[model samples]
Target: MNDKPAAPAFDRHMLEALVCPVTHATLSYDAERQELISHAAGLAFPIRAGIPIMLVDEARQIKADD
Candidate 1:
């Protein structure tokens, strides 16, 4: 049985305020991956169940490398 609460759906206003933690840049939501992608920084922050994974640790690094 799924024990997680359904994540709250974000509206346009909230999406506008969403930013990359690393670069503090704008993010584009990818409904497929349920992630907030920062193209400039090349990072894709995951969203679980519906809630966004805003934490750096939880985020998946994109084209950018260490």
Candidate 2:
């Protein structure tokens, strides 16, 4: 394998427009996990490569207690 890291897919402005389906809140992209987290909603949405996996089933639920 080349072992070279891939470049960041989305920038801050792009992420700013992304919203949580469950809560309709803003999303914070986690490049490491490739997941989008909604802190207020406590949900984690997965991002495949540079694209977001916006499906509900693909998303992770976050509890307020977490």
Candidate 3:
């Protein structure tokens, strides 16, 4: 029997409703990285267990090269 907890499922509908807290711009989902990318804010908000951490303090600054 599997003992590990199931990972939370990401909802596409919810993703469409989310915006960047800093820029109030639309966000793009990076499914491979499990992050929400904000081009206007130049930050990437991480999604842990399918729950997006939208706080800027918790987000990673995006590089030009990225």
User: lDDT: which candidate is best?
Assistant: 3
| Clash count (model 1, backbone only) | 0
| TM-score ranking from best candidate downward | 3, 1, 2
What lDDT tens digits, residue by residue, belong to model 3 across residues 1-66? 879997797787887789999999999998889999999889999999989999999999998567
Screening candidate 1 with a backbone cut-off below 3 angstroms (N, C-alpha, C), the clashing residue pairs are: none
Give the Cα lDDT of each candidate.
0.78, 0.78, 0.90
Question: What's model 1's TM-score?
Answer: 0.70
Error of 3 at 54 (Å): 0.5
Off by over 4 Å in 2: 1-8, 63-66
- Given candidate 2, what's the lDDT at residue 18? 79
Tell me model 3's lDDT, rounded to 2 decimals. 0.90
lDDT of 1 by residue, 1-66 (tens): 979876676554668778888888999887767788888778888876567778888878787542
lDDT of 1 at 22: 85
lDDT of 2 by residue, 1-66 (tens): 789897558555778687888778888877778788888777788877567877788878877764
Better of 2 and 3 by lDDT: 3
> Which is the leading candidate under TM-score?
3
